[model samples]
Target: MLKLDHITVVPPTLAEGVRHVQDCLDIEVPFGTRHEYMGTHNHRLQLGDGIYLEIVAFDPDGISPRHARWFGLDDQKTVRSNWDAGRRLRGWVASTNDLRSVLAKHGEIFGTEVPLPPENPVFAFAIPKDGSLPLDGAAPSLIDRRGVPVSSEKIPDRGAVFRSMTLEHPEPEAIERLYEELEIDHPPRVVTGTEVRYRAEIETPSGLKELT
Candidate 1:
């Protein structure tokens, strides 16, 4: 079954992105090696419950763009914005084993799957070359690195664990249908907003804290 995987943070540079997450979450995050094929490198922070947050950025010195690089900042205005001023939450990714079939069923909901390098062993979803997906110009792209996701292992949860994740969106029925199409395990509860908001209940030393 498909599941809500992780979220992405797009900063203009890897160092800056890592710093941003560290400041907001008040934790230490480590820089990971580069995905040569994607022309990007990242840092990871664990958010408990097999979920993580990734801070990613293009490698300025790399020669080619990675196949699944999300966040369309190729243009001057987008670049100037620096992936939505770095304050935006960007987007989320869903993962499934049967990606090919899933895409065939809901091809209209997203863009083409960018082929990752064989060495990288993952696939991803991003806006189509024609710019579909109604991203509001600030969403980060969705990526699924094959095997186990990096965040599942690298980031330490300290003492916290995710109890549940709740998503808010308009057109509850339609969104519910989309999740059903993907075979996602969690059934999203419908709300009034066009944007997706995540509410996670985490266990800490003090007590359970609701993180939004």
Candidate 2:
């Protein structure tokens, strides 16, 4: 079954991304390893359940494949806010033990799986190459780096946790059917929206805060 894996945050640069997140949430994000193949590095934040947050950015010094070069970094601008004023949360990933079979089954509905480095073996279902997720007011395609998914052991979790996640779509029936076909857990609620919004309840030092 496909499960809600984690959310990815793309920033112009690795350092700026980490700093921006720290300033926004008033929390420290731990550093993670770099993806030599994609020219990307990341910082991680643990959430409730097995979910986590990944702040990823392109590293010019690293070797990135030609196909993965059309993300946000190409524009040379940094993300000032975590949610891009609510425009973020462009897409998400679903975990599976057999990604190849899943991709083959859903290939017609969801575009082909983006290839990842051998070291990072996870696959993703994303929009077609011509259709991309919008970022910085532009629609850019989404890519998945499978093998490098955030491991459960790495997230610190602190005191906060993710209770649940909901994906809103105008075609709720179609989305529901897709989830059912993929054997993913249907969210308790579905709302209407052109883009996806991720809401979570997290435990903070002051108290509990609902993160949207």
Q: How does model 1 fare in lDDT?
A: 0.55
Q: Evaluate residue 64 in candidate 1 and report its C-alpha lDDT on the 0 to 100 scale.
A: 63
Candidate 2 lDDT trough over 10 residues, lowest sum: 132-141
- The C-alpha TM-scores of every prediction are 0.70, 0.70
Per-residue lDDT of model 1, residues 34-84, tens digit only: 877656677765666576766666677764663434554334254336445
Q: Give the clash count for each candidate.
A: 1, 6
Off by over 4 Å in 1: 66-68, 73-76, 79-87, 119-127, 130-151, 154-160, 163-173, 187-190, 194-212
For model 2, residues 1-212, the per-residue Cα lDDT tens digits are: 66666665666667766665565456677887787765667777777667677777767788856543333444344333434565343344456656567657655444455555545555443444433343221211234445566567877666656565555565657656655676765332445767555444456665665444
Off by over 4 Å in 2: 69-85, 113-116, 119-150, 186-188
Whole-model lDDT per candidate: 0.55, 0.55
User: Positional deviation of 212 in candidate 1, in angstroms?
Assistant: 7.1
